[model samples]
Target: MKIQIRLVLILFNSCLCLYGQENPRLDSLLNVLKTQKDDTLKVLTLEELFLEEFYTDPTKAKKYIEEGLELSKKLNFPNGEGFANYYLGAGYYQTIGKNDSARYYINEALDIFKRIKHEEYIIKMTNALGVVEYTSGNYQKAIEYYNIGINYSRKNRHWDNLANRIGNKSLAYIKKGDYNLGVKYSIESLKLFDSLNSKSNTLQLKIHTATAAVRVGYAEMGLKNYEKALEYFERALGIYDGIDDIVHMGHTYSDIGNVNLELGNYDSAIENYMKALDIAKKKKIPIMRGHVLINLGKTYIKKGDYEKALYILKEGLPFNEQFGTKDNLSLNFNQLGNAYLKNNDENQALVYYNKSIALADSINAAEILSDVSLNRAELYYDIRQYRNAYLDQKRYQFLNDSIFNSKKSQQIEELRTIYDTEKKEQQIALQEKEITVLEQQAEISALQKILLGIGLLLSLIGIYAIRQKMKRNMLEKEKVDAELEFKKKELTTHALNLARKNETLENLKSKAQELKDKENMGRGYNQLIRTINFDLQDDNNWENFSRYFEEVHKDFNSNVKTKYPQVTSNELRLLALLKMNLSSKAIANILNISPEGIKKARYRLRKKLDLSTEDSLQDLVLSL
Candidate 1:
């Protein structure tokens, strides 16, 4: 037993040593290649260097992938072209958080894979594509690709690959809200993984299972699974201790942080998030760094540290936007709005809320939109903007109803598809048995084969029908693509125009603000008198009035300046009163003048400004 324990300790030590050696060698090779002059050698070395760095140092991995892309394009090698694009896509997906662009390049590689007929490349790209789709909320499309990938792997007798594909398929199904099916496939995948006795895969399977359970809202089950996941993660961590598998380690910690967060263990969540952030910063992985920042912001928000939450989230928003994730941007904005509200900055809260709504609208992020609208309605209610609150509440209600109905419809559709598939499989099996019997009978009586000939003709007709259907489907896809491209261009143009208009409006607002500031500099007594006299300037104020008030409120400068080429400063006060929508009594009270005197001043101002009843004196002063 002592010898066995010592051997186990040695094995563990050896694993750590191997993991530690990986980073320094990768760093040294990367530095050497950075200064290399030969293009071919540089390209070749960079590709290998990027793959080696991907797990430990994704930011450096991205640099190498970019360099490889440029070299591959220069060399004009199709194989290298495919590889470079694939690497660049994965690099962006993994490091820059640009999954859409990652999907694009991965699809490009998939097209090349078909031309090259490389099964390994095809399966890998397919699995990657599935991941992209799954992340994008297209769970059905992801499952379709994963199924194909699984079939290919199985046909090639690649058990490890088949298990991985099955695991991915299970994740997609779970995301699609098919928990039973997800569990079924997950179990199958785990069984295969255990049979293979692959330690790496065993750890991965535990993580996947925990994640799926958590996503499906089975939190207790999730936590149970996560215990196993934690055991494996720690095992891996121990093996990789003192080694800089910073990128993978960071992601692992992030995963742990998320699980802990869901379980309401904020302290543990913070611990893991801080660890992830430290590694991400040291590795210079901007995307993962941004992710950790957002997660940290959430923890702060939950802890009621509104100021710190806002600071962290605002800093992280630009990174998320630069990475082209409108969804993440919307989340950040929503959080900011909430933080501002918590800090009692209602105006700022409204602005951020509106921004979040706009981004959510742009991305069709239904959950964000619903939550924002509800929050906005509550804010409006607090401000006594009842009508606006009612409108927002109604909108929120409508969205909630739609989401509920859509989810129900999707569930019904899923059930129907499952039922149809099972029925069709049974029919196909029975039909195959009938065909075998018919063939046996036909072979025994070879003279009467007209039915078999007719069946063959019918099969040909069916094949032709299938071909026609496929052709129609292809045409439909092309049409959809064209329409989508045109709409995308239109939206781009609209957004540009809207941005320009907003800029103009902001400038106008700034000018109005400057005028208000100037008014604040002096004129203290005059401003006070204007406010007081506005209420007394009606018909009742005619009996009591001051002569100086009569002088100041006698004429309207806006009118006089237009009619006589210049107006006195006293007349400007009367004109400003007219612009303020005050009654004659209010004007008299403000200027210590009689109502008749205020009326006289108003008439003089109107006449001086060359105003008419059709256009109010208020509009005239506003234009000036």
Candidate 2:
């Protein structure tokens, strides 16, 4: 709430005073309430007073809520009624486990907000419902609501709310025992808040960043990174200290206590928890008090003060049950069982352990179940119940394995989500930079005189058109060059085929002549020689090669002929082969000559074309 108010105040230029996180002193609010008339202002003031007392005194908060609801209904003010019901529902669920009543009042407010098309209130109520589910131990349902808020906030570019939703989602993951994922998402939330903070030095963004940091601490604590978790917790404490956020300040102190407890710093743990307890009691925050009380008792148990542990645990049990989730209550039971066991009260220890196990099973807290099962197993073995001990030992193994496997899958999913989120964050940053550049360009364009701006716009258009035309021409030239290359390869293939056929014919002609030299010449044998020679010199073979060559180098024939009027058709054919970049041996085969003869023919052609000694025949022909 503090984070949202600060953002709205700075970014939107003003914030709704009634909806702000700050509340007037009880005396001040009472005076205003007495003097204020029965209108919207009175209803709004009542709502604000309800919020001020909501976490501290549920009964007093309810008085303000009821009065506000009745007055708003009489005035037909949906927004006021929505705020009243929302606060009432928050009090019902958080103060006591009135699940049905909580859902009824919250949903009623939601319906009213929807009817009035109050999008912001709808989002707030939806998040509240999510918190309700989270408090009820419905982790998945809570995540679904957080996702809804994330989607809406992202679409609206409400970065503060988006960061809050993401931070809330991390809490759900932590509760669900997906600690790695909780850390990943909490870090993402921190980064977003940091980005917003970098954009402007707003206290709201800093508070949100600290809140995200605290969530990271919780997630790290879940992963057993005590020292690292302490760093985050202390950092957040520093921020909350600067603000009048009693609710978060107490929670942050409790988180620091938890890290100290994990690190075996019993004295430090007690100190932090006592600080949290002081804040919780002084501010009348039930949830914070309950949480700190439970941790304080656990700290004493760790310090080997069993009697102190037992007394503190018993004193905090009622508060924990009333305000905390069942899983936390189950943990408290397990700790109580441990304290009793340490004090050598076997019967009381067994009773508390059983209660803890039952609660853990109901909530499907596999990690808690595993711990309790192992503890019970040891107790049973101590009591000489071999069979019960063995059964609990098996249950512990099963739950431990299940939790390990569940964490493996969650880690895999988290890896993919982290990658996708990183990609999106990068894209968003790039887009924001682009928008800044565009805005600057728009400002520059606006500053330019109208006629000059028109002239510059016209010049840009003309330059763009000319550049486009050049690009098109270059593309067309490339296309023609590619076609020419293809044709050249095809022409080479045709020429090679003709060369092979000509070789066979020349061999046959030699055989026929050999026969004529060995014996007397016959008419049919001479006719065979003629046919072989004719086939060797077939124009049909040249026809296909010539056609492809012309297609490959369209201007070659005309340009060469025009340059050298004395050039013959045969020399032009040799020039075409040279332009194809054929080897001397290949050219010899195609022209029915030896390699030496083909080289000499090229030398003669070069001289005929008036080429210099330094000139490359292939380079010259290729250019043509």
**Where is model 2 poorest over a 10-residue stretch in terms of lDDT?**
1-10
Alpha-carbon TM-score of each model against the true structure:
0.56, 0.62
Model 1 residue 323 distance off true place after TM-score fit, in angstroms: 3.4
Candidate 2 ranges beyond 4 A from true positions: 1-20, 136-141, 195-206, 419-624
Candidate 1's C-alpha lDDT?
A: 0.61
Q: For each candidate, C-alpha RMSD in Å?
A: 20.9, 27.1
Residues 494-553, candidate 2: write the lDDT tens digits: 677566556545655666676677778666568877766676677876786888788867
Which pairs of residues collide in model 2? none
- Taken over the whole model, the C-alpha lDDT of each candidate is 0.61, 0.75
Query: Tens digit of lDDT per residue, candidate 1, span 10-66?
Result: 111211111233233666886888698856667777877776676455676778877
- Residue-pair clashes per candidate, as listed? 17, 0
Best by TM-score, which number? 2
